[model samples]
Target: MARFSYRGRNAQGQEVSGDMEAGSADLVASQLGSQQIIPLSITETETLGARSFKFDQLFAPRKVELDELIIFSRQMYSLTKAGVPIIRAMRGLQGSARSPLLADILGKVGDELESGMSLAGALQQHPKVFGAMFINMIHVGENTGRLDKAFLQLSDYLNMERETRKRIKQATRYPMLVMIAMAVALGVVNFLVIPSFSAVFAKLGADLPWPTLVLIATSNFFVNYWWAILVVLTMGAVTVWQYVQTDEGALKWDRIRLRLPLIGPIFERIALGRFARTFAMMVSAGVPMIQVLGIVSRTVGNRHIGAGIEQMRNGVERGESLLRTAANTQMFSPLVLQMLAVGEETGAIDDLFEEVADFYDQEVDYDLRRLADAIEPILIVALGVMVLILALGVFLPVWELGSVVRS
Candidate 1:
């Protein structure tokens, strides 16, 4: 018998993990099923050493995007729904994959399945492309004999996520464009326009107005130290990028983002929407409460919320209801709590969570509509002020000089 490592929730909902001697990983999972335990993952010990290798760091292939996943899921669901075998579906997908990297990954997945590795096990080897959430859901689908439905649910989830992201991008696009325009305008004035005005003022030999003096000094700085400015900005951006890649730094940064004004609530709604929707999907898919919570707590994309969900999972493991545990966390709104309470009572938690997700969707939609109104005015006013400054700083002296020349 081969040794396998497994983690799962026991019949009493307690978290349990240990090494078990079984003929295969599938057999280990079957053993757990016999004990009424929900297996999260079961990996044979022989491959465990190689699984931990940092493939992501070493390979650095083209990263997978949400749109790509959405397309993949949709196609996979259609094929599966049409009764295509998993291997044939994957091979067909490999042939049609838009990205060469994705095609290669699909080919690898098919090869692994050919060699008798479970879908989850094969996908686990490509962590950069597929996350734990994707793997766990596939495992659940495989176990429950609902692989088609699983692909359909994943497709829906990914599509919703993609739409939400598009909305956010739409909401911010105007502001981003405004800032870029302002930057370009400022650069033109600093290097080109201001220098011309400064030369004319110097030729006039007049004592400059304070604004003009300030503008000339700024132009001089841009002219003399532009390289230094560029270097500093580049270095600062790289530093922040690297720092945000670390665990603690990312957690802190995520927390900071949630507290930011005007945008924080948007992200919070996004996180809640994701949680409610994924939770509903998993519940509806017949995944157990413990397994659903375990998978979702890590996939919500917000560290603070994920941590709270994890705490709730542990609470449930200790014989606490999800609602009571959620109440203690104080992360959810009262309306959501009420809905969840009703769901808990009615044994329709999935339906209630779907409603909750819809509510957040409406909230996000409203906020996105309001975001343009909120940010555009501020950006416009800032742009106006900058223009007013440049007019006063550069034109006043030119006006005086022109008046003198005309006279």
Candidate 2:
């Protein structure tokens, strides 16, 4: 018998780890399952030792991408819709998941299921992997006997979210590339070209223009202290990343994100679209309006929008109309408000929310389609201005030197 190391959560959702004598890692996982432990990982002792020898492996985090979740959801939907037992479907998924992180999660969920935990309960053990909205929908589906439908809905939402995010990233790509190129060009001029020019001016023994003097000093600092500059920039970025993970800092930044130039409206539309779609889907699935609103509030990417949703939830709790609560927040445009009012009057609120989501989707698509057109002109103008500044700053002194030599 070979010894294998296993890490898992017990029935109480607490982590448990140990080594067991087994024929294989799979056998170890089975033993853990029989012991009511949800196996997270089961590896041969030799493999464990080898992993420990790699120092970088000890510190590296497991990353689960959105695309992986999208694929997993679709797979789950197909399996469940085909009438396969949830356990069998989970086991199949665990074996076939492309992402190691996702495979590990599915394996643990399977272990929990083997130990008689409800699917939602098993998923709840890893809140970060399955968000509150996801778990809630699953719970609703399990209770409603529509697990297949829930996964199908989740797949659609995730696909839409992914596409929307892809569009935003694509829209920003050109500008990001332009900025990086500009930085590289500036660095080249400062490090290579500027020093050569300064050396020539020094040999000429002529007093330089103020712009040339400024450029020379800037180049010298960069040449001497590039490491310090790099360190400062890295520290600043790390600090911002850490701060943005905090609730208050995240809220502040999310609010600022909505107010940013050029992309602010796009962000607003995306947030509203997410809110509307989630609300519509959950409400249509027989989830209580209050719970639906609460879930939607927490999942919206923008904290400002989330806060508005929470406020609307609270207002609804106080016996106010959904339309009134939504309108009072001043979050929705007049057209959306009108639609909500009509939906309320007609008792077709879910359908109206769906329409609202669709409207925002189209609006966002239209804006994104023209984003390059809007940004390209600005980029070109900015690039021209930068070239003009560099020309005036660098060439004026060279012209002065030429006039002196001629005289």
Candidate 3:
């Protein structure tokens, strides 16, 4: 949809102007009319020039952080529960918001609210900050008059996500630090230490072993063509980054991420857990089955897994039972499948989905606890091999020289 700037007079004869996304100027006018505003003009907002980079944005935070979203949800829940008017609550939040971006967004949302847009509709304007699932839940809540409950659910879900992310980062930090140290060591040896040893060995004029020859050759290449190597590495990184930004590449990369060694299972469990939690929440909130599937599919985080959920939605639309459709996806473990079956039979799918989420969370926790232990041995072996190679390459030459001098 294109964004249009509109000017109008509201019910109290107050003049207002704001930007809104819609298909056409007529649609924008129609929306304003619904809000009891007589539209003076609606014009499509001009797009920014492609080459016009905003330097200030480099240091400014444009995107809302997860922590900010969680706080917003929590505060909104409290305010709504206290029966505060939605517009006043939004204005209060906007004034008190720590993030300038979030405050600006809330201000726009408040304006939209004053213009008679639903809460969900106003929030939908910022897709980057509020995801499809979030907007849908609010939409459902508005329809069902349970907006407070929706915010409560969102806060819970965001907290769970935040906890999972923290655990993953904690578990992987050691391995990441070790790998970085190894890389730095490798660079230092090649660029500084090995060159000195190579010069000494060249002066000795003794027959060098293959290990020393390999080390000298590697060091020489690093010393000679470092710029070329750096350029190649930079280009490769840039290429990969660009590729992953594309739809096909992102899908492929996400699939590959699920199969990565040592951490693949962790990624899978996290994605599946997110899906289960969202599914359970939507179902318990009385969202339609079809709509729940659609929302959960997009919000699952892994594109490959999301495609599977999309297929399940299609199968259900084709008149297949939820159990049958889910089984056909082949994404769930037998235990989860069994739970789903029982839930389907007992008409308690939401409760069963909750159980599934808990099961995955437990599995994720257990795997995370073991993740450090599992990766440590591999890192140790790698460090050992590097040390052994350097030892053999350097010491063997010294041993030969000593023998010759003694003889």
Which residue runs does candidate 1 get wrong by more than 4 Å?
1-61, 399-407
The sequence of per-residue lDDT tens digits that candidate 3 reaches over residues 1-407 is 67788887878888777788776788778877765678898888754343357788789896999999999999999999999999999999999999999999999999988876678878977888999999999998898999999999999999999999999999999999999999999999999999999888778777788898899899999899999999999999999999999999999999999999989989999999999999999999999999999999999999999999999999999999988888898899999999999999999999999999999999999999999999999999999999999998999998878776787
Candidate 3 Cα outliers beyond 4 Å, as residue runs: 1-3, 7-17, 21-42, 50-56
Give the distance in Å from residue 129's predicted Cα in candidate 1 to where it truly belongs.
1.6
Against the hidden true structure, what lDDT does model 2 obtain?
A: 0.87
Q: Cα deviation of 395 in candidate 3 (Å)?
A: 0.7
For model 2, residues 5-55, the per-residue Cα lDDT tens digits are: 667888888786655555577877775676578888887766423334577
Q: Considering every candidate listed, which one attains the maximal TM-score?
A: 3
- RMSD (Cα, Å) for all candidates, in order, is 7.3, 6.8, 3.4
The Cα error of candidate 3 at residue 361, in Å, is 0.5
| lDDT (tens digit, per residue) of candidate 1 on 111-189 | 7566545676667657778887787778778889888888888888888888998999999998998899889989999
lDDT of each: 0.86, 0.87, 0.92
lDDT of 3: 0.92
**Candidates, ranked, lDDT:** 3, 2, 1
